[model samples]
Target: MQGLSAWRDDRCLYCDVDLSLPTGTVMQIRGPNGAGKTTLLKHIAGLSGRRAGQVSWASTDSHDDRDTFTQQMLYLGHLPGVKSALTVAENLQALAACRGINLLTHTISQALNTVHLGGYDDMPCHQLSAGQLRRVALARLFTEPVPLWLLDEPFTAIDQAGVRELEGWLAAHSEQGGVVLLTTHHPLALNCPLQFLDLQPIVEDWH
Candidate 1:
């Protein structure tokens, strides 16, 4: 992105933001509360249009080939985005279907197991705890074939073990030439180097 700017209630959340991420890279957005971390992610994911900036993919403008870009990217927001009444497996299937992805039964089972949701696949999501529900959402990552990931607070409500597992997944994705951009408070322990973008408040000088 270049010259990215956003406003909320006439208050500037951020301005003149610039970023670039290449393959096999992992970038973390760091800032204090209300620093527009989520806003930046939303813009990159094309979820929010109230911003001034240019987002490109593979040296081509995103606006020029939005359909292709959308197919290559996956964005996970704060909410789990699961149906409460659906079974864990069913929810995963539903999410994949919404994205027009076809997941075989074994693929769904493998993804569930990857997030440590193994035998719980048949259980109703409403019966699962908060962390379990989060896991259900995270399982999507394992099944998604896209190379670019935009995650907001992906580590929330999960245990230390889950955090470590996620870090491993991020590292693996990077090693396999995928790109990941995420916002999280937990210190990442990945073996790969992490690039950072700190969104300072508008009151502060930005360099």
Candidate 2:
């Protein structure tokens, strides 16, 4: 995100929350509730049409950026976005398909296992608990090869073990030249160094 700003009805909500992230870096966005954390992420993701801002992927600029960004980016929102009718593996398949990925069945199962859902591959998502659903959503981290990850409230309904497991993944991604941008209220224990983007002052600074 570069020269980033967000507004609602012509009133500034998030002002100048610009960021320059390098590969192998983790950027955490933090603030109190209703501080525009999610909205800021949405703007970066190009989902906030009502907001004014310029968001670029790599050094490429806004025009035609979404196509490239979408290709390399994996976005996990506050909602798990899992389809209850689909089995765990099927949901992962859908996620892989989003990036035009084709993974073998065994590979998909292994990814589920990595997320601590070993035997739940063929089980319908509705049969799983809230945390399980979140895990299913997280399984994409393994199946997708996206280099940019935008996660909103990723820790919601996730357990401590899952949290640490995710931190490990984040570290690995950073080490492997991936960029992670996320919003969370919980403090992260990441092996990679993290940069915090506090939205509190950005919110208060808006005029």
Candidate 3:
């Protein structure tokens, strides 16, 4: 699979900017608050309708191939998609089932351990601290292997150590030829070659 072009329309928040990100690359979308970072991520994740332009995947011209695109991508947004009522293990298991990945007990345990949540897997997410919950969310990175990762504000609520662990995981993912597109204000301590896209330049006109 190759990269795709993401174009914007006049009614779109980003106006006329179009970005083409190469495959197997780590693309960072940087901007101030409310600069459409989340919007761009939503579009890439196939959660939002394109106002005018399109996002193509693998050079395929068929819009019916969205499922094909979705299968190759794992999207982690501002919300961890965790249920406050469920245990950490249950949340991961549910997500794995929905994504059609068979998440084993050992895999869940190892993922929690990677995110430093080994002892908290059986606990309710509400019982965990904000940072700990974020770690639990990030633990999915270890349990699942997808080609494209789209994360919005992944560093939110994470401590320094947790941030380091997440960065290391991302670096390793890119090294294994996986592509990552994320929005983060925190300076990343990564060894991989990163491409930065400043979304601030694409301002919307309210007129």
Candidate 4:
């Protein structure tokens, strides 16, 4: 359960805040605009440097392995990390390759279908609508198996159905003993137990 504890300094975006997220727990970081929720998520994802406090992962070994930690986590930012010139299937294939996971065309199709983008698999990302593009970014959740998922503003441009689909995926991930840390302004309706970690109070000055 116990994992990382992170905080910030004067120049840090989120300011002074520390949090300890346990494993397999769905923690929601809620805040107003410019509260640094995304910044915090990036820190947890190991995409940003910590200015003050440390982000420590629990390990039984004598030393913490950065490569292992990176491999254990997946960070989905607000922007869809896709190539505009590439087809939907190609994007997933590239991501899987970068992560050292081999993805088949059938698996990519299934992932696209799970996100309700089955018919758009052959289309380039630039041609897809904003919602469909978001769906394409989300399709990776089904095509790959990663233990920890760190998502920032995942519900930004999706419709109600997309939200529900994402909720279902999150529930399934948590059911399999996976950890999820995300930032969302919209409320989520799920069948499993959930926890809310309000970051609104922590970064009030930024607004």
Per-model TM-score on C-alpha atoms? 0.94, 0.91, 0.87, 0.85
Task: Give the distance in Å from residue 153's predicted Cα in candidate 2 to where it truly belongs.
Answer: 1.4
Better of 3 and 4 by lDDT: 3
* Regions more than 4 Å wrong, model 1: 204-207
Candidates in order have lDDT scores of 0.90, 0.83, 0.79, 0.76
Ranking by TM-score: 1, 2, 3, 4
How many residue pairs clash in all the candidates, one count each? 0, 0, 0, 1
Candidate 4 lands at a TM-score of: 0.85
What's the distance in Å from true for residue 99, model 3? Answer: 1.1
In model 2, residue pairs whose N, Cα or C atoms come closer than 3 Å (at least 3 residues apart or on different chains), thus clashing, are: none
Model 1 lDDT, residue 69, Cα: 88
Best by lDDT: 1
Please give, for residues 1-207, the per-residue lDDT of candidate 3 as tens digits. 223223455444565556665666898998887677887788777776553356666776325687778777888988777999999999999988887888889999988888888877789988988888788788888777787899999999998887887888888888888889999988988989999878764445669
Model 1 TM-score (2 dp): 0.94
RMSD per candidate (Å) reads: 2.5, 2.3, 3.2, 3.6
Model 4 CA lDDT for position 203: 37
Q: List, residue by residue over 36-146, the lDDT tens digit for candidate 1.
A: 999999988888757888999888788899988888888999888899999988888888887888878899899888898888878998999999989998998888778
